[model samples]
Structure formats: structure tokens, C-alpha cells
Target: MQTSTETETFGFIVNDISRLIRAEMDRRTTEAGLGLTTGEGRVLLNVRRFGPTRQNLLAERLGVEAMTLSGLVDRLESKGYVERQPDPADRRAKLVTLTDEGEAVVCGMEPITAAIRADAARGIDPDDWQLLLAVLKVARNNLMAARAEAQSAESAAA
Candidate 1:
């Protein structure tokens, strides 16, 4: 029932915008001399946001491959930004926590992120922005629910 063009509009438009936003964020991070790639910055921010957590958990939250997350964490650890300690709750599992230097990077990122967000929303009305956020949140929840349902069905079949 759906036209190809109509079906494609949502995905392409959203994907393009997401890509551009990431590119702009990467540019700003480099211009600010943050000494982090966009991906690294993202990991740093997530660690800061969630506190000390397992690498696998962080990978899940970031929607990245575990190996990729491991590499990022390793780099960050060598740079003195993060450290991996044996999780108290699970000795076999390691928890990634930010060090003082990592905290500094997280602090430094706040203003840059704010500026980037402000720049992106420059012409948008605050009310409209809030409404847009609400719609997106619903869409995200719906997708998550669908994924969970599919996983459940797959597990049952197995």
C-alpha cells in the first residue's frame, strides 16, 4: 500500500540528519582540541553518564560491537582516562570507571555538546523541540519493544 518514496523518506531523512550531526560533533570536538575521536568522545560521555559499568553493558548502550568498545576502552585506559577494575559483584566481569583525567574530559565536553546542540537547534522554537523529542522517544520505545518481542520469539523457537 505504501509508495516506495514515502516509505524511504523517514529512513533516509533521519539517517542523513543523524550522520550530519555526528560529523558536526566530530568537527567541533577536534576543533576544541579534545584529543578524542568522535567515537571515543561518545564512549567517554556514556561512561560519565552511567558511572562505572561493564564493557559489555556499555557496548549495548552504545549499540557498538563489543570488540570495538573494548578497543576504545583500551585506548582510553592507556591515555589515563579510564581504568578497568574487577567488578565487585562479579569478579570475572570488569567495570570501566573514569579516572580524574576522564572526569576532566567529561567536564570539558559539556559546553562543547551544549554549543553543538544549540547550533543545531538555532532556529527551532523550544516548544517545537520538546515536541520533537517526545515523538522521537516514543518511536525509540516502540522499536525497542519490537526488538524484545522478536528476541523472545526467536528464543522460544530455539
Candidate 2:
């Protein structure tokens, strides 16, 4: 029932909507005391939510390179927000965890985070929202696996 032109228009609308939501999140998050960059806020969140996580695994989850991850960790560690401990099974590896200060920082931003997510979803019917979520999840899985495969191929080629 859908035409190609209509589908294209819908894609453009979705892209613009996604951009607007991201910009709003950036604006409100900056207004919070998170400071500097969105990456910092994201790092704080990850360390708070997924800390005691291995550095490599954290880097993979963030979809960032090791150097980038290290830099984020450095800033957080300096702020007394995070710390690295030796992995029990791997002496060469370290686990990252959030300090009490880090938790406080993330907790303080909770209201803003919830507000942003809710605003982005405003006016969407429950069924439509769930359908969009399901489709997006499938698309995300395909893209992620494809990206990993492409990276592996490039590495092999190099």
C-alpha cells in the first residue's frame, strides 16, 4: 500500500525528528552540571550503569577505539568519578567502575534524562511506538553485525 516516494518522505521525516531529539537532549544535558561534552555524560552513564566492566568490553560497547575510551576514562578518573581495578582473572586487564561521586553525578541528571526520552516519544500511540521499536531493533542488529563484518574484512585486507 506504500509508494516509494511516500516511503522516502517518511525516511526524511524520521531523520529530521531524530536529529531534533538529539539536539534537544544535548541542550538540556549541557544545562545540567555534566560539563563539556555529551561523551562525558555518556561515559558517566556507562560507568554508572555498566562499570566494573572490562576496559576492552566497555570500549566495544561504546563503539569507540581503545584510545578514545582511555581518554574518557582519564577525564572521569581525574574527576573522582571512576576508577580502574585489576580484573581478577586477567592480570593484564583492568575493570572500570563508578565511584560514589560518579553515581551522584548520574543521579543528578536523572530527571533531565527521563524528560528528554519522554519528550521524544510524545504523542505516539503505544502500539505504534512498540512497532517502531521492534523494527528499529531488527535494523540495529543487522547494521551492527554488518559493521563488524566490514571492519573484520578491512582488517584482513590491511
Candidate 1 residue 127 C-alpha distance from true site, Å: 0.5
lDDT: worst 10-residue window of model 1 = 2-11
Q: What is the lDDT of residue 106 in candidate 1?
A: 85
Error of 2 at 155 (Å): 10
lDDT score for candidate 1 against the true structure: 0.90
Residue 100: error of model 1 in Å? Answer: 1.5
List the global CA lDDT of all models: 0.90, 0.82
lDDT by residue for model 1 (43-143), tens: 88998889999999999988899999999999999999999999999999999999999999989989988987788779999999999889989988999
Cα RMSDs of all predictions? 2.2, 4.9
| Total backbone collisions for each predicted model | 0, 0
Off by over 4 Å in 1: 1-8
Question: For every model shown, what is its TM-score relative to the native structure?
Answer: 0.90, 0.74
Worst 10 residues of 2 by lDDT: 2-11
In the range 1-158, model 2's lDDT, one tens digit per residue, is: 97465645746877887677557757887787566366667777777776588989988887789999999999989999889999999989999988998888888778888897687679999788889989989877998999999999999999
